[model samples]
Target: MGYCRSKDLDFAFKVFEEMALKGFKRNEVAYTPLIHGLCVARRVDEAMELFAKMKNDDNCYPTVRTYTVLIN
Candidate 1:
């Protein structure tokens, strides 16, 4: 999470992958940090991928805050 806040997407994704493999339950709190990091790093495509993954895989619907970050 700190990694994500620091805009370290590579590390963030690595951690995220490991967590998923270990059955860490994802919620909006988890997704938001990564999404915000990706956006801050200007990796919009990767952010969108995360967004899609959140919806499709994790069943975590996005919030207005998420959309707002992605949009602006």
Candidate 2:
């Protein structure tokens, strides 16, 4: 999140990938910041892809705020 806030997406992604590799269950809690950051960075296409992945991903449900973030 700090990384995302800093707009350091490359680092954020590395960290997120590490978390996933370590078996950390990445749900919307994790998805939100990345998606929101991507949107804010004007990379909405990537954000939308990530949002869709959340749907296919097991146990990862997007919150209303997630939609709001993307929509805005």
Candidate 3:
């Protein structure tokens, strides 16, 4: 989140990938900030891809905030 907040998306993406590699449960909480950061960085296509992946995850789903991020 600090990475995302700081707009350091390269490190942010590294951390995101690390979470999956380390077997951390990827949930909405995990996906949202990266989505937000990507959106902030004008990377909407990547953000949408991530959102699609999140939706495909059995344990993950979009929240109101997630939709809000996309719409904004």
lDDT of 2 by residue, 1-72 (tens): 899999999899899899999999998888999999999899989999999998889999989989899889
Best by TM-score: 2
- Of the two candidates 2 and 3, the one with more favorable TM-score, higher being better, is 2
**C-alpha local distance difference test of each model:** 0.84, 0.92, 0.93
CA shift of 10, model 3, Å: 0.9
Best by lDDT: 3
Candidate 1 residues lying further than 4 Å off, grouped into runs, are none
Report residue 59 deviation for candidate 3 (angstroms): 0.4
The TM-score ranking, best first, is 2, 3, 1
- Which residue ranges in model 2 land beyond 4 Å of their true spot? none
State each candidate's clash count. Answer: 0, 0, 0
Q: What is the lDDT of residue 17 in candidate 1?
A: 82
Better of 1 and 3 by TM-score: 3
lDDT of 1 at 54: 86
1-72 per-residue lDDT for model 1 (tens digits)? 899877678898898889889998787778888988988888889889988888886567888987887888
- Per-candidate TM-scores read 0.83, 0.95, 0.94
Root-mean-square deviation of candidate 2: 0.7
